[model samples]
Target: MTFFLLRFIFACLLLPCLWTTASAEAVSFPELGSAVPGHGDVTYLDLARMVIPDLAADKDGFFRGSIPIEMRHIAGPDYDGSPPATSGLSSGDVLNIKAGGKDRLAMLLDLGDSPDSAEGYAVLALYDITGKPALLDAVNVAVDRSTYFRDPGKLSIGPGDDVIITTSTHFNSSQGYVIAPLVMVRNDRFELIDMIYTFDENLCTNRRTQNVAFQAIADSQLYAAIKVTVTDATVPGDESCDGQPPPEASSRDISVTYHWDKNASRYVKDSDALDRLADDNAKRF
Candidate 1:
């Protein structure tokens, strides 16, 4: 009888130790800051895995799974940020955004050789945190040194709007670029609008830099528009800009607008403004 009692006591002691060890293995939101593998003791990838239990990197360093098919469809065929088969898993950027009147986690996962920069490919992962962290949706976002998402900011189209805007920015030695995309929640899922607003300013060596201002105007209870006003100014070029090309004359200031078409489920692009911008890009950089 004494032997059985002692054995029971030993088993009880061992079980608590085992339980503690198991509990330590379970990850939570707070543990995202804990030690992982790369980038000091912890990495942004570790935070991603903590938030997304199914997302993991393989032995070869690539992600173990693919993004949801529905998100891919929403991104459309022309979207070039699709995950490559050869790109390995790397660090990412994490931020908070509002969706459904609650806080949601947004992660721009880097899927390129460059881990935490404006260069290389990336995938946007959104998670619903109303309860447990659950992946709401994900999509590939384009990234390049001259044109990539850098220090993305949050914006709302109108008062109490569920739409979120993400900015992509780059400084290509002589010019600065900003591209903002509208992400909205519709039909129980996140959707990417087909239109975008852009701003670019070049160095003063060859041409005058354009100063642009963006404003969100609520047209009505259900519709909104983005107003872009552009004015030109001659900025002095620094030593970094080696080419002292002939100065070009400045043109009159222009105002452009893009409207959200609810029926089309996307924002309608300003054709004239878009064509002019495209032509300038083709002719210049």
Candidate 2:
């Protein structure tokens, strides 16, 4: 079937990332039913595999920090009551899934409270995973109610122990969609960081297309997190850089994409990965 083949190819592509390691105990998010709670459906590889390097320099590549995330996946199910993964917007709702070690802290991105509807905005919530999860901090970072859906998002690590992400918005009024960079960083206090030109849409007409991915900043000394966005613009804005969209490509309709640039030179996209993920979703059943 198409779905099987797609997963096969995707896994093949990621083969370089896999290694034989001692497998950790597998725990499921029973209530939410995804690898990560509230993230909707996605493949749950072993918790051991889900672990990223620690934020501190002195520690080994594992996050010895309080947060131990058991589940994390860049590609998987779309979490809309579907078994196989599906692409595109499921709801305008922002969810804070249980993450961190032992699900100790539930960091969520709440993107729904718009005048029109919660249609893809941000209302980040950090919760304490008690016997019952307790909402510790609930803050609204950004909102795009006009014609955008902010459902699917990716996570990364920013400088200074910050969490960075890149998410896309599907517009209701425009012809092109938007790709943006957002972050949860601390300044004396924890605050969300929104990059300037994250939108892929024009002030007017962008319809389809989505943006995602947010790789941690490998070199904390040089810059912020590295992002791999999907864009139709062969150069830019067909897929514009965050905050500084190209004038000509600002309002065009296009398909999905995935691209990577080693240097964070204006949000380059890897149309291949995005295209592959979308392609895989279609055949996932």
Candidate 3:
């Protein structure tokens, strides 16, 4: 009976150790590739390669090749199984910024199959001083043809250390490239706080169109120089035309300044100055 009692006690003691051993067994994630220690500091490229084992690296040790289609998040948000987009790390498709006194990384990902179309979404991932990563935000930006020919978009640090992202996309009515909605990272989140410059085709019968060009001007204050060009449709002398010879093509320039509203903890446009600029531009053209 004493031997049996000792055996029972020994088995009970071993139960906890067995449970601990099982618990300590490294978690196996087939999708994330081989298990590696100290994975907390993995960069975007590291994660990309894990998800896409066939990815190739460039001469500069950067991954610049396209991603496999099977690794994309096509239907829903399955971040564990597949990343939503792909990026060319060597082509300025990734941006690092500082916001709220923390390091933030953003990447423009290609979501479409057509290499000629810059149709993709964006992800802003935040990391701490220790390099622990977290997803700050994600957004779907309009595709721009220019991106296919060059880098996907431009990301910069705006006034008050805010993140500014610029992209170009096609507007059907505009019939040309128009600036996508300006995205700003404020309060650790992505916010579309500014209006985009677009063309209105209904104003004239000859299909007069307008296009806006923008540049970020940073000094003591954050400013954007927006140049708007209105192009009147040219009617052939032999073709029959409808309404009054469409208004003459004209161009207007405006400067918009942004201010950080402490109360809201976000950047707000200078309404009075914007109104004045709009009025002046309206009178000019």
Best by TM-score: 1
The runs of at least 3 residues in candidate 3 whose Cα sits more than 4 Å from the true structure, single-residue gaps closed, are 1-43, 47-92, 113-134, 143-160, 171-174, 200-247, 272-285
- Can you write out model 2's per-residue Cα lDDT over 182-204, one digit (the tens) per residue? 54433222333433232222332
TM, every model: 0.60, 0.35, 0.45
Enumerate residue pairs that collide in model 3.
Answer: none
Give the TM-score comparing model 2 with the true structure, all chains together.
0.35
For residues 27-72, what per-residue lDDT tens digits would candidate 3 score against the true structure? 2112222322445455455544433445656676645544543422
Best by lDDT: 1
Worst 10 residues of 2 by lDDT: 79-88
The C-alpha local distance difference test score for the whole of candidate 3 amounts to 0.40
In the order shown, the candidates' Cα RMSDs to the true structure are 16.6, 16.8, 21.5
Q: What are the per-residue Cα lDDT tens digits for candidate 1 across 47-69?
A: 46643435666775545434423
The TM-score between candidate 1 and the true structure equals 0.60
Total clashing pairs for each candidate: 0, 40, 0
Predictions in order: lDDT: 0.49, 0.31, 0.40
lDDT of 1: 0.49
How many residue pairs in model 1 have overlapping backbones? 0
